[model samples]
Target chain A: MKKTINIPLGSQHIALLEPVRFSFTCENETIVGVEADVGYVHRGVELACTTTFKFKQVGYVVARVCGLCAIIHSTCYTLAAEELMGQEVPRRASYLRLIANELDRIHSHMLCLAHTAENAGFEALFMRTMKDRELVMEAQEAMTGNRVQFDYVSIGGVNRDITTDIEALIRQRLGLLKEKVGEIKELFENNWSLSLKYKGVGIITAENAYRNSALGPLARASGIDFDVRNESAYLPYGELGFASVTMSEGDIHARNMVRLLEVFESIRLIESALDGLPEGEIAAKVRGTPEGESYMRVEAPRGECFYYLKASKGQYLDRVRIKTPTFGSVPAMIEALKGANYADAPAIIASFDPCLSCTAR
Target chain B: MFKALLNALKNLFSAPATLNYPFVSSPKHQGARGLILFDEPKCVWCLKCEEVCPPGAIRFTQDRESYAYTYHYNPYLCIYCAECVRACPDKAQALSQCSELSRPTSDPFMNDAWFALEKEAEDSKEAVKELKKAKKTEETPQP
Candidate 1:
């Protein structure tokens, strides 16, 4: 005879950044089943986008969807708007957009890494990752005019242009960050305690990842070669020699390694983008209103962020639909949590790097 | 184990990584978006900032009788996108990277310099009406 008990992990927890509830049914110490509720932070952002904001202002409005990936949100919407209006973005503006997006990815990946280390009870690693992350934040601020929510990408072009002084600053800081990340990467790979806590835990097989439609590093870790940056022309990712990082294990360690390796790729892309920076107008003359429907997708730090816009020849939009990456990954997250030990649950949750704000909004 | 000890020794000799906040501010990269600065004299009361603001952070109002315009900016609601700064034709509003956003007891933004223009326009309308009346009375005597 087996005795099972239900334990609730969160609606509010010390480890979680946003509100999400999880109830795990455990047989002794092993979790037999898991259920998640992800609507705790929903503020009706989709409804507000269509009803309240005009087509021109929706780019900035959608930036409020997620602070970590604000530039991606604005850029995706701007791309759709430009497509509908038949406007052409200059090469220089596209390069600026690419640089901002990659910088955002670097900082976001570092934060997720820090959070995972903190969950594993390694206080020093958490602090060190955060300290090194500041270098990327400094680069972001110098170029975008804001640290987190930059409002860098507008409809026709970007809001701020990068000067030569800012360019030198970015190159210097990224050089320093690359050296520090190498140290952090070595620790994640070789440290005994982290290996014990992270290795072979919360495994998501390639089949499970595909069946549940997992995205981003989650899918990549499971040997799924799907990255929006490779598929979409929303940005000049290919011209900058973008490469997707993939692994086979699909465990917590593999996920961490995938993000770690991608950071290096992101740095390379940023450097190449700067090296080939073009000379042209930063903005184009946009005229008329957007008519008909358009869909846009961009590779956010987490996964694919998709936006759907339906507009007439009016100032306001007819409908605005946003499909955030975390929303699509919830089912996959639940699948990974089952059969894991109760004590390892927080580590598993942090490994997914779920952005509940983005999911709910 | 040796690597752990080596890292510990390195950290012990190096300066602390943490910053002393409020005593010593963290270093900000260039082009940081901070508090907003409003220049009232340059504003023409076009209300473009109010229209373009995503969060409705900036509001412009007019007193119909006096024709005076007043502006209000709620720093709490502002997202610091600087869309308002870009939308203004006169460049009346700008962003300051070093200025901090503080909570005040009362609203700090209110301006009304367009009252004189409104009054002059009203007086000219009245003068035109009086001239038409004088012309009508003279024509009536002739008829």
Candidate 2:
């Protein structure tokens, strides 16, 4: 009776990172078509940013869009609002923002890597990766004064200044993380079982990635060479000699490798930013309200997190439009799923590292 | 596989990575964001903290007869961002963030009470404004 069977992969599944549903049309364990639903977790964050909250309070509001990249959201929005208000952020504040952002990237990348390993049925590696991830979490908590929702960045400048004690702690933790990541990298690379699940399981051609407009490591893994960090000067990444990591494989393994490599780069950036940290007032005296329309892009751990802010000289913004990376990468995700084996669906989807909450918001 | 065996042996000897919660306490670092502590005596009743708090965790209810302000804070509603502390006047310094905030009361009454208190705060302020306006009219007489 039924020729092609349809299998659904979740709004709730054991392997998914967030609440997202994907239906795969399979012909004998090989996927022929894919459909995704990413709007299940929408919280109307964009509408709230404009209507409910004032311009000053919107920074904290947008930070709740996604827990993993909370600071990144605030940083992007703060930068946009600052541009509108003509606010000059202090040098030390810029460097501190950079450090916090890099730390966030490291921790977020680790989380994705850990989940990818877990979804591939490597629970031991997943646990070990999460254990090492605590180093960055501790460093972040000590530096930013909060763990997940770090309301560190405000409009004019950052809320808190980085101290010498916190600096040393960050350096120490990153050092330990560097060694630990090297070991994880080796395991991801050399382990025969991980290779079987990852290496060529879910391949996206370079053309396909570019055509579908894949973002972040998903695009970079396919050799597209697109990274928002290198493309923008939102933070002090240029001064820190930031480099984007890329791979040619375009498969599950390549994505994991890209994340692993980026973690190392993120660590280096944080340490560098710390060493060259300047001294100045942490926050500037904010004088005026934002008057003009301005857009900002920050390299969130997932991908390019963009904010289009329009304010007409008022406490409440006229409009706030957010373009999250997961939303951009969904088309590419469905494309990748079209030819993948049904068994490797979890691994492939995990490698994409979709944040449905961020997407839906 | 050899390295895996070695790691297993080493892990067996080493301490567990996670803390034993409730038995041994978790580590609290310096400058960790915690509770918002208010000093009633030092407070100038300027209501800066109430105005700047993002979550409306802090509120002040005004008594009509005495025209005195009573501070009401629900720790659960607070995001602990310290925006209120930053907004507070340096001279007043009435609001400060403590290093740690454990779970406060989780009862629904606290949450429901906050809604009632918020309404009362607005109503009381409105009542006082009307009273002042009425007094001014009386003082001016029929103009």
Q: Best TM-score goes to which candidate?
A: 2
TM-scores, all models, native as reference: 0.89, 0.98
**Candidate 1 docking quality: incorrect, acceptable, medium or high:** medium
Across residues A1-361, which tens digit of lDDT does each residue of candidate 2 receive?
9899999989899878789999999999899999999999889999988887889999999999999999999999999999999999889899988988989999999999999999999999999999999999999999999889999999889998877898899899899999999999989998889898998888999999999989999999999999988998888889989888999989999999999999999888888888888877888999889998999998888888999999899899999999999999998999998888999998899899888888999
Compared with the real two-chain complex, what DockQ does model 2 have? Answer: 0.70
Looking at model 1, the pairs that clash are none
* CA lDDT for candidate 2: 0.90
- Model 2 DockQ class: medium
The lowest-lDDT stretch of 10 consecutive residues in candidate 2 chain B is: B102-111
Candidate 2: TM-score?
A: 0.98
Over the stretch B72-105, how does candidate 1's per-residue lDDT look in tens digits? Answer: 6666667777888878874444323233433434
lDDT of 1 by residue, A1-361 (tens): 5588999988899977668899999999999989999998888888888888888788888888899998889898899889888889999999999999999999999999999999999888898999999999988888877788888898889888889999999999999999999999999999999999999999999999999999999999999999999998788988877889999999999999999999999999999999999998888777889999999999999999999988898998888889999999999999999899999999899999999889999
- Every model: iRMSD: 1.7, 1.1
DockQ of each: 0.52, 0.70
Q: Which residue ranges in model 2 land beyond 4 Å of their true spot?
A: B105-109
